[model samples]
Target chain A: MTDKTPHDWLNEHGDYLYRFALARLRDTHLAEDAVQETLLAAIKSPSFEGKSAPRTWLTGILKHKIIDIIRKQGVEQPAEDMSQYAAEEDPADEFFNERGHWADRPLAWPAAENALEQKQFLSVLQRCIERLPPKLARLFLLREVHEEDNESICKELQISPTNAWVMLYRARMGLRQCLELHWLGK
Target chain B: MLSCKQASELLSQSLDRPLTRRERWALRLHLWICAACRRFGRQLMLIRLAVGKVVAETEQNENLRLSPEARLRMTRALESGQ
Candidate 1:
């Protein structure tokens, strides 16, 4: 319960913290600012009793800081346009095709593996990922690319363990289907 | 004893290695009879392996080519008074 306790927390956790912020914010300056504000707020809290790990505690503060930053930046979606990302496809049509299959019989694993080896495939993949919704894209980037664990991913995404699993599933499915349409010559 | 929905849930759960023995059994039984689930599993496998490979290549190239200034900044923040 010392005044400088949060300083120590930041010092210990800043790398993890910065990466978290940068990945979410996609801007170095903003992430740096978020980390600074998080440190300031965490130090002043009576709740900084170290009940949880310092990393977890600091990340919790950063999460809210991110939300506030996003809000102040007027990142809200128009209510009418909100469903654009949410309205992907008719689930019945997607999961169950007219011919009664997953609809797109995906190419072989090695075909995609070969795609991975090529520079052009990567360019294509990046383009597709950029088009992903922020939440879903972040989740996909973390879980699939960054190799984050289910527990860490769930906490970061602020979802139920089950919901995290579901979201991760969708992220994988969406990214693949999108990339397939874009690159795999479906 | 698992329903089709539960069996479907087990499909991903099994992939994650967190399924109970009973759930695993139910999923296996379902996949044995349901070509749909089998195809679904293949899709998941292909997608995962493909994505994993893509991640490896991109990760190698991305951090390697970070602008020197951005690299300096991240490095400095990491080393500062910690």
Candidate 2:
């Protein structure tokens, strides 16, 4: 019980710690609040033993805070609809593509990594991404994009392994067609 | 005589790579003559490529952030707690 715990280390590393939380939570007030809670919990439990980088320790706390923020936001911005992103509230079908393929023809582009460097590239991708269903976008973000494995994505997205596969398939299909149309201009 | 769903399921596999030799022959034969399936295959390929690009783009941006403020806030919280 001789450990300094989270609160004891705070005065020495306050600004540094807040920076970590702010990066994830994206709000000044919330970041402050999350740190406050993490400190209170660490002091009460006395489990914040001295070991790894204190910054890392705080970051772990902030990560939980970030997750809380995301969950409280009620829903991750459903990846499907760009319109919804603007309005921030919209009811839409999970899989609304009636067609057998992507709505937009794929746009030819420089390699994706190359395309990302340019701001204009995202614009061409807008419609095609909009075509993806919410779950599909989330899956795409988690899987191919994030390099997350099937198990982790399924757990976070609350989807079955089978559904995860389908969403990925759908995501790929949607993006491919959209890119082709843009790139080929057909 | 695969149903629409069955054919669709196989479509994903085909894009990754053609199905088994026997299945490929059947599918290839079907795609050769069937305009609808051919278009469908084309659509799927296009979609696949587009997603591949977008996914790459998303990852590159994933860890990036506007700045590092959380750590400072966490430190403040700790100070307050004491």
Best by TM-score: 1
Error of 1 at A167 (Å): 1.2
lDDT of 1 at B66: 33
lDDT of each: 0.58, 0.51
lDDT of 1 at B25: 76
**At residue A134, what lDDT does model 2 achieve?**
42
- lDDT string for model 1 (A98-186, tens) is 54455555454345456556766666666776777765555555555444466754554455566556555555566667767777667
lDDT of 1 at B46: 55
lDDT of 2 by residue, A89-184 (tens): 322122223433322322334554565555555556655665665434534543543334557545654546654445455565556555556744
Question: Interface Cα RMSD per model, in Å?
Answer: 6.6, 7.8
Give the per-residue lDDT digits (tens) of candidate 2, residues B5-81: 34545676554333688787776776666555566566565444544565444324434332346556555655676
Off by over 4 Å in 2: A1-36, A39-47, A76-99, A119-150, A153-186, B1-82
